[model samples]
Target: MGRLAVGGTRDSVGVLCQVLKTGVPSALLTSLSLAQNNLGHLSAMYIGDALAAPALKRLRKLDLHLNRLGDRGVASLAEGISAGGGMPCLDELYLGYNKIGDAGARAVAGCLEGMVVLRELDLASNAIGNEGALAFAMHLSDEGRDEERMSHVRPRLLLETLDLKENRIGDDGACAFRDFLACAGEHESGMGGGRTEEEKIGLYCPKLLNIFLDQNRAIRARGRNALQVLHTTRGIRCMEGADW
Candidate 1:
C-alpha cells in the first residue's frame, strides 16, 4: 500500500513497527497517518525506529498529531529519526497536540536541520511558549544566513507552511518570526547588491508562503500588528482565521 491510516492501538502500532523493521509490505508506502490515537511516547519510539527501516524509505508524509507524545517522546523520536540516516525522503510532518513544549520544539528543530527536503510542519495546539517559538525562528534565520554564505553547497529548506496556533507564544516569540521572515535586521547590515528580492531578504526560507499564529492569545497588539504588516505589505501571509 502506498498509504496507510490507523487510529492506532498500541498493539497494532507495535505490529506495524515490526513490519517496518523487516522492510516488507510497506515498501511502497509514501504516506502514513496515525492521528488522534493517543499513542504516547513509547509508541513514538517504536514509530521512529520503524521510520528508519529500509522498506519505508519512500515515505514522505507522516501524521502523528494528537498522539500525546510529550517532550520525552518527541525527543526520542527526534533522536531515532536523526540517527542511522533515517527518513531521508520524508517531507511533511504533523506533531501537533502532543504536549510538546520548549525542549521538544528545540529537539524537533535540531532534527529538521538535517531534513533538507522537508516542506510543511504543523506544531499547533501544543504548549510551545516563547522559548520554543524562538527556537524555530532562530533555526530558520540561521539556515538563511548559511544559505546566503554558501549558496552553492548548502541545501535550502523548502518549508512553506508552519502552523503554530493555539499555543503559548507571546509577542517576543511572535515577533521573532517577523524579523526572520522580513529580514528585519539584515538590511541594515548593508548586504545589498544587484540581488533579487528574495536574495535581498537573506535567502531564509524565501519560499515560505504562510504561517499560522492565530489563537495565541499571548500576542498583544504590537505583535499582531507586526505580523499583519508582513501579510499586507510583505509577501508572507501571517494569520489565517477570520477571528484575527
Candidate 2:
C-alpha cells in the first residue's frame, strides 16, 4: 500500500521529514519500496518513523531493502513499534541488506510483541546469525505462552510468513524453529482452534504457513532434512531452495 522509491543521492531523510512536518498525513501510504537508495546509516529509521507517524495508521506494507541502517536503526524502529507510535496497521516489513545483528533481532522481537497485525517479516542479508535466530525464537516461545504478552497484540495476529534468506543461522537455530513450529501446531490442534481461554495455550503459538530460508549456507543437507522432518510433523510449509 505504501510504495516509495526515492533513488539517487538526494537527501531522502530530510525530504521525508519535511513531508511529515508539512502534515500531509501519509496514513494511507503502504507498500513502500526504497531499494537502491543511498540513505545513510540510521536514515531508514528516520524515514520509517516519519512515514509511520501520521500516514501508517492504515499502512500495511513496507520495503526498505539495501539500506545502511545498522542494528541501532533497526532498534529505533523496534522501539517505535513497541510504543505503537508508528505503523499500527503494518502487516509486512522488508529489511534486507542491512546490518541487523543479534541485538537488532532481539529488539525486533520485542517490538513484534506490539505488532498485532504483522503477518510477514523479511530480514534477509543481515548479519543475524544463530544467536540472533535463537533470541527471536525465545521471544516467539515466550509470547506463545504468556497471555499478558498477547494482550497488546491480537491472538489472531499470527505471522503466516517469514523470509530469512541469506542469513547465517545454523542447524541449531533451524532445529529451534522446527521445534517451535511443531509445538505450535500441536497446541493449536489441541485448542480445537478456539481463541478462548478454555483451550489451553501451547508452548509455541501462531501457526506459520510458509518460511523462506533460501541461501542459508549453514543449512546443510542434513539440516535441510531435519527441517523437512519438522515441516512434515508440524504441517508448516518450508521453502528452502535458492529459488524460493
Candidate 3:
C-alpha cells in the first residue's frame, strides 16, 4: 500500500466501519493511511466508532493528515480510543495537518494522560501554537517534576521521534520545551517503586531521540541556545528551522 491516498471520499470511512464490524480480528492490520481525505468531523466519528471494534485490537499506525478532522473530530477519536479499555498497544500516531489547533492538541493531550506506549508521533503543521506545543511537550518529557510524590504509578511515553515542523511554537513555547528537556536531563530516579532514571527523565517513557521543528520562523538563536541543555545528554537529535 504505497501512500494509501483516499482523500475526497466520504464513503470509505463507512466501508471501514463495516469491515471493522465483521468481527475478524485485525491482528495483521498494522498500518492504515486515510490522509488528505477531507474526512470531516462527522466522518471522523465513524472512523472513531470503527476503532472501537474489538476486531481491530492490534491496529496501530493511523494517519489522518490533511483531513478536515478539526477539534471535534479529534475529540471524538480520542474518546473512542479511550473507551472500552482503549488501544493500549498503539505505537505511532500521525495527526499532521488536518487543521488541528491548540484545542485539538489539548484533546490529544488529555487522551494521552496515562498512556505510555507511543514511540513516534508527528503533529506537523497543524496550526499548533505555544499552548499546543506545550501540551505535547508535557507528555513527551522523560519524567515529570513530581515523580517522588506518586511513586506507585508509571506515567508518560516512550516516544523516540517527534515532529512539530510548522505552525506557531514561538519563543515561549520553545523555552517550555527547552526547560522540559533540561529537567529531563537533570532528573534522577529514586530507588523506590519509581522507574529507572531514564524512565523517570521521560516519565518512565525514555528513548526520545529526534525532534523536528522546521519553518516555524519564530525560533531563533535564543531558542536554540536554550536547546543546548539537551546536548548535555547523548543520543538526542534536533532540527530547528533552516538550520536543519
Candidate 4:
C-alpha cells in the first residue's frame, strides 16, 4: 500500500492494527497516519510494535498526534522500537498533544539514537520540561569523548526540524538548545577535526534548519537572548515567543 491515512477513525483503529499485524510487507508502505484517534498507551504500544515489524520498516512518515498517549504510552512505544530494531528508514514522526512528560521525552531521546535517517520530530503541546529538553540536547550534540564510545553510540545529526512548542521548557531548556546550536556550528565549520568530510559536514545537528520553542512561558530574557545570538550568528530560524 502507499499512504494508509486512517486518521480520525477512532472506532476502527483496532481493525487497522489487526491489518497491520497480519498484512503488509517490508518496503511496501511509505506513510501511515493515525492522528486524532483517541488512542491510549496500549494502542501506542501496538503501533510501536508494528513499526518495528519487517512490514513497516520502510515506512517514512508516521502521524500519531492529538491522542492521549501519556508518558507510559510513549515510553512503551520507545521500548518497542528499541527492542525490535525497526523503522530504520522512518523520516518524520508526529506525536503532538500526547500529554507526554519528562520520562516520555527521555525515552524518545533514547529511541532517536537509533533512527539515523529521521529528519523531523514533532512533540508540540506536550508536557516536556528542562529534563526532557536537556536529554534531547545531549543526544543531538554529543560528539563522543573517545573513539570506542563514538563507535558504539552515534549522534543524531540528520534531524532538521524539532517542534517543542507549548511545553514547560524554561531557561535551562532554552540554554541547552543554545549549546546544541554552538555544537552544530563547530561541526559544520570543521572545528572538531580528525573526522572525514562526510562525517563532519553536518555533525551535531548541522542540518537543523528550524526550531520551535514558542509559548513556553517559563523562558526568561536570558534564555531568549542566548538563542538570539545563535539566530543571528548561525543563521537558523527560531521561534521562542514575542520576545524574539
lDDT of 3 by residue, 83-138 (tens): 66677777778888878888888778756643457777788887788888777666
Error of 2 at 111 (Å): 1.6
Q: Ranking under lDDT, best-scoring first?
A: 1, 4, 3, 2
lDDT of 4 by residue, 127-146 (tens): 99999988887677653223
lDDT of each: 0.78, 0.65, 0.68, 0.76
- Per-model TM-score, in order, reads 0.85, 0.78, 0.80, 0.84
lDDT of 2 by residue, 165-223 (tens): 78888787777676555555443554334545322333334555666777778977766
Write candidate 1's Cα lDDT for 43-144 as tens digits: 988887786667776789999999999999899888877777656778899999999999999888777755667888999999999888878876775533
lDDT of model 3, residue 166: 83
The stretch of ten residues in a row with the least summed lDDT in candidate 1 is 143-152
Stretches of candidate 2 above 4 Å error? Answer: 8-10, 143-154, 185-207, 242-244
Clashing pairs in 4: none
Which residue window of length 10 is worst by lDDT in model 4?
Answer: 143-152
Candidate 3: stretches off by over 4 Å: 1-8, 25-27, 113-115, 142-152, 185-203, 240-244
- State model 2's lDDT: 0.65
User: Of the candidates numbered 2 and 4, which has the greater TM-score value?
Assistant: 4
Winner on lDDT (2 vs 4):
4
- TM-score of candidate 2 on Cα atoms, chains taken together: 0.78
